[model samples]
Target: MLEKPVNEAPLADVTPPRLEIRNLHRSFEGRAVVDDVSLRVMPGQVTCLLGPSGCGKSTTLRMIAGVEMQDSGQIFVDGKLICDTVFRVPPERREIGLMFQDFALFPHLSVADNVAYGLKGSKADKRARVEELLVRVDLLRFIDGYPHQLSGGEQQRVALARALAPKPRIMLMDEPFSGLDNRLRDGIRDETLAILKEEDTAVLLVTHEPDEAMRMADEIALMRDGKIVQQGAPYNVYTRPIDRASVAFFSDANMLTATVEGALAMTPFGRFLAPGVPDGTAVDIVFRPQHLRIDFDRAGQGPVPTPVDGTPARAVVERARFMGNESLVEFRLDHDGSIMKATVPAVFLPAKGKAMWLTIRRDRCFVFPSEGGA
Candidate 1:
């Protein structure tokens, strides 16, 4: 046999994506609900489909679950075509597990029976699967109990066990923990995440809550108007947002408007670089409230500028309130009288009308073209 070339490219993996969507589209009465949306999830990874209501997040999930048909594009599992314009697989045979907001447990069935509902095997095999999942979810003691006998969290766990009993390769969760009590929601969500990861199931969770997506997702697909505006890891999606709306979606934003003269937009804070932007362009400088640095006005003068903080801006406290974890101070700018907010940790409740100096981190701020600007 000939010696292998030293620089030969490595062969691609024989295993394909556990779930993949390619330019999926759906419409209703000429309105495009899900337009050319595509995404992929690998084994044991969790990808969150995050967006406001009516943005097609759930519709996309429905299409993937094989309940809703797409108008175009293809769905694939392990490189095998599952759904498209003409051909499709049955939802029950898709090997995908589903967990919804409602536990959807059968009231008449026992916990063990509910879990064994989807399993295909002899009686002994089904019972073994049910017992295994019940132990994993810590509900083995409830084996003989009916769904109505369990608390909200316990019922949800039983639902989770039922979904996992078949050992699905992909799990589609649609706000599964949203209905639980606040105290139980976090714990159940964490437990479910741990179990899914342990089972090596690719999870596609749909939720509008940013906190859930940030804490639970390995990847986030931010959808809007039937299109994904950005997709990335949680850190990148939050810190390196693609546009102004993207920033506002994750947190409250304070925007300062200025026209670019020479690749810089001047504000009371300082001139921020607008690299590659035209000289005559109008831009908006946006920063989160937590990025604002507050200091007492020293003898009616703001502090000197620094490279890290850019420049100090003067403002008067319009309102201040204690928000438990932090104090929020609203200010009216001295330069333009525009309102902005600052959040300081701890119990800081400054009197209204108090004058203060504020500085902003240039690196923490984002500059985007002002909406509707030429």
Candidate 2:
């Protein structure tokens, strides 16, 4: 069981965001796709909207880019109201650059011409700007290459360069790396982030991968069926999820239900003292895999205690899996069929089906009321 922190910072800030959505709503076929959603994207920061498929993340992004009309609410970019009930701005006039999942490049146009297509300047000036953007995106050598001649990663870079041609104030990316393989995706994402940071462009990215969001975002907004359930800094959301779904999606956690007894919790595994929990209250504890350390004794040791004071519940190892440099062990409790996952160093990994002792760090756990389903 983790002890709750005594003090935490407030989530909302007083300063205005560079991009703001107020009471945003959208619907299709009488079904609400984006229902009463609101968010803020700070200048020069990457904010990721994450959720499962059909969760309205894409709808929200399209609405912000002016590609889709909102049924209600207002959208402001840099304090300029671009969307309202009666007033609607076309996508071209929104000062927002968009990069789609598919690299939508003109097949007949050269890479350089594609990048220069949207610039409002003389021919020579436009060509010069295109060359600069191509170099910034690390695709200067492929300026003359056609879309078919370039690799997937190369094509993605060209598309990004084209989006940056107008030097828009904000960029909207819809799963820009989802089409590429894992290795290429990593490299391209890094390059893209570097270029965006250098340009200081405010970006709102939509993706379903939690790891991607954790790795690339300054802030994350977790959405459900058309509604944002939680939004905060990456670390804040990971360490302190507001609900069970957020907790499971953000990390690998062993969730167990128990009832609080004084400061202690009584579960089938054993009794544990959980700080900040009221007595007689039913609660669920989220234990991260990294927080638990397991040690297996080759020479059989005596049975491990249920609760090791100052820590959380204890269990014996039921199985262990060797994963490269580390080992993942699953433990079964003495009192219940509940299982917990723990990651330990390869050197200290227990033998498969062997008995091992487990200890959970109290400071690293998160507790919530037992409300069932993840």
- Alpha carbon lDDT at 236, candidate 2: 89
Global Cα lDDT for candidate 2: 0.84
Candidate 1 wrong stretches, greater than 4 Å: 1-10
Candidate 2 backbone collisions, by pair: none
Candidate 1, residue 231: lDDT = 97
TM-score of each: 0.97, 0.88
Off by over 4 Å in 2: 1-16, 268-280, 297-316, 347-349
Worst 10-residue lDDT window for candidate 1 reads: 9-18
The residue-by-residue lDDT of candidate 2 on 1-374, one tens digit each, is: 99767797657856567799999999999999999999888788999999999999999998998878899999998888999989988889988999988999999999988998888979989999998998788788888989999999999999999999999889999999999989899889989988998888899999999989998999999999999999999998888888777888866888778888888776543565677877778888777787776655445552455434242344576787788887788888655757889887664556556665556656666677778522
- Summed over model 2, clashes come to 0
